[model samples]
Target: MTIKWEALLQVFGATLLVTVLVVTLFVIGIRALSDEKKGPAYASFAGCVAVVLYGLSLIVF
Candidate 1:
């Protein structure tokens, strides 16, 4: 059987991008909370949760 190298690379790139995005959002949320900014902190956290839920949905459905 032949491996599809292009498809494998695409999946790897997408996974890497999502991981970075989630980490960045979490860091921003923490920093905002420490700086006494509640609004942005919550928003960032919500974004992270939304991404997680979306990923779960993709897996389930």
Candidate 2:
């Protein structure tokens, strides 16, 4: 049986995108909790979670 490599590549790319999003949220959370420029950082962290979830929807379906 022959396996389709294109789907594999799509999955890999989506996975990488999700990783980047998670790391971005981590940085945002740290910066937000710190005593410097306390504003959009926290919101950004939340947004990151949403973004990752949205990305997963694409990968799963």
Candidate 3:
């Protein structure tokens, strides 16, 4: 059986990219939580939640 190298590479690259994006967003949310400002912190948390939900939808759909 022939290996589809290109498809394998594409999946690997996509997974890596998504992993980085989600982790970065989570970190941002955590940092915002520690900050004194309330408005930006809430916004950051919302953004983090949105990204996570979107990622889940991507996996399910």
Return the top candidate by TM-score. Answer: 1
Segments in model 2 whose C-alpha atoms lie over 4 Å from true places: 55-61
The full ranking of all candidates by TM-score, starting with the best, is 1, 3, 2
lDDT of 2 by residue, 3-59 (tens): 889998998997898788789877877877785655767777778778877877987
lDDT of 1 at 29: 100
- State in Å the error of residue 59, model 3: 4.0
Q: What TM-score quantifies how close candidate 2 is to the native fold?
A: 0.64
- Number of the top candidate by lDDT? 1
lDDT of 2 at 20: 84
Tens digits of per-residue lDDT, candidate 3, 1-61, equal 9999999999999889878877776677677778766677777777767877897998899
| TM-score comparison, 2 vs 3, better candidate | 3
Model 3 error, position 46 (Å): 3.2
How many clashes in each structure?
A: 0, 0, 0
Ranking by lDDT: 1, 2, 3
